[model samples]
Target: MSEKSRDINFLKLFGKNLRSIRESKEMSQEEFSSFCDIDTRQLGRIERGESNSTILTVKKIADKLNLPIKELFEI
Candidate 1:
């Protein structure tokens, strides 16, 4: 796949996973960001697919939320 297509797919998946997990944990963006040590603005960007997070950041979020990265994409 082209880089653009890959980016689109990945971004969509990431955003979807973020919303699902946040809801599951009963976390508002502010709450989740506090748990994950990220700013609410950054979390909003992530949920909107507007920011590309680093692997370490993603891992921190997954750990903070008590989820595996794979489970983050679960439907």
Candidate 2:
């Protein structure tokens, strides 16, 4: 399909993976956000694939989760 469509799909998949990881860790969005020093609403937006995240933001998430950066991109 189109480039935009591919980007959207990537975002959705990333969000789904992130949500799964968080749930597996038994952390609520609020708790994860606080630990990551991020806003809860913004974390929700990211998890919902409603926002485009920067590398830095992703790094922060990976760091907070104690996961490798590459793991964040895993489907």
Candidate 3:
């Protein structure tokens, strides 16, 4: 795969994992975004794999979820 393709694949996987985890916590996207101190729209984009989120944003998410940063990337 091209590098861009690889990155897209990874983003999709990460987004899937993040969505699963968030749902497992029984939090709506709005609630979770508020908890993570992020914009609800941005969180939605991240969950849909449409945004290239920053590491700081990722860290904020993981922190809010009480998970390690690596957990966000788990398949």
Which RMSD does model 1 reach against the true structure?
Answer: 1.8
Q: Where does model 2 exceed 4 Å of error? A: none
Residue 36, candidate 1: C-alpha displacement in angstroms: 1.0
Q: Cα miss at 50, model 2 (Å)?
A: 0.9
Collision pairs in model 3: none
Instruction: Report clash pairs, candidate 2.
Output: none
Better of 2 and 3 by TM-score: 2
Distance (Å) between predicted and true CA of 29, model 3?
Answer: 0.5
lDDT per residue for candidate 3 within 7-59, as digits (tens), equals 99888888888889989989999998898999999988888888999999999
lDDT (CA) per prediction: 0.83, 0.92, 0.89
lDDT of 2 by residue, 44-73 (tens): 988898889999999999998788999999
Rate residue 50 of model 2 by lDDT: 86
- CA lDDT for candidate 2: 0.92
TM per candidate comes to 0.83, 0.95, 0.94
Which rank order by TM-score, best down to worst? 2, 3, 1
Query: What's the CA error at residue 33 for candidate 2, in Å?
Result: 0.6
Error of 1 at 29 (Å): 0.5
Give the local distance difference test score of model 3.
0.89
- Clash counts per candidate, in order, are 0, 0, 0
